[model samples]
Target: MTGSDAAGRLDDDDFPAYTMGRAAELIGTTPAFLRALGEARLIEPLRSVGGHRRYSRYQLRIAARARDLVDEGMAIEAACKIVILQDQLAEAQRINEEMRGTASQESDLPPG
Candidate 1:
């Protein structure tokens, strides 16, 4: 679904707030599993004012994707590596786009 579709389902305030128990429930996984995912750096939960793990909706979605990958017969280690690579690729793409934008701006500038 698109961002608009998700936005229509819940308010913005709903996105940034979830206890570990609630996050596990929302992702259809166990609390222990969610903790393990955090340990493995699969999903990062926000730290509350009291140092509690406050999982956002995005973290729940990451857990769901990890579950899907594991369910598809991928080894957990491999799935984790794939997720890391995907994040790195996205970052690289963003950097490339920014560089292109800068180059385009320079090209549009008049000669000194």
Candidate 2:
């Protein structure tokens, strides 16, 4: 896939794209900061067969949000917490959708 500039929608082809240093350069952050986020579980790094940190476009977006929160004067820990909560909320929403879909499917079925 062709490269996408900032604000462009990333595709699966964007996966396994950025190495740690390159990702740091693209996000305007240090590799240490990215590692810290990984330690905090804010962003899960994709590990290669040799265990190197490979970042995806989606992970870069998370890093961008963490950077934004830090620049807004929030502490890194607080920023990490916000990111975690947002992830949990997204998971909850996904589960709710699945449950609702199951209910709908059941309603559409004939009585047993």
The prediction achieving the highest lDDT against the true structure is 2
- Regions of candidate 2 where Cα sits further than 4 Å from its true position: 1-14, 46-52, 108-112
Clashing pairs in 2: none
TM-score quality measure for candidate 1: 0.72
User: Which one wins on TM-score?
Assistant: 1
The worst-scoring run of ten residues by lDDT in candidate 2 lies at 1-10
Per-prediction CA RMSD (Å): 6.2, 5.4
Each candidate's clash count? 0, 0
TM-score of each: 0.72, 0.69
**What lDDT would each prediction earn against the true structure?**
0.80, 0.87
- Give lDDT tens digits, candidate 1, residues 76-109: 7677778878889999999999999999999999
RMSD of 2: 5.4
Instruction: Tell me the tens digit of each residue's lDDT in model 2 across 1-112.
Output: 4456532534574576789999999999999999989888888888888899999988998898898898899988899999878988999999999999999999999998
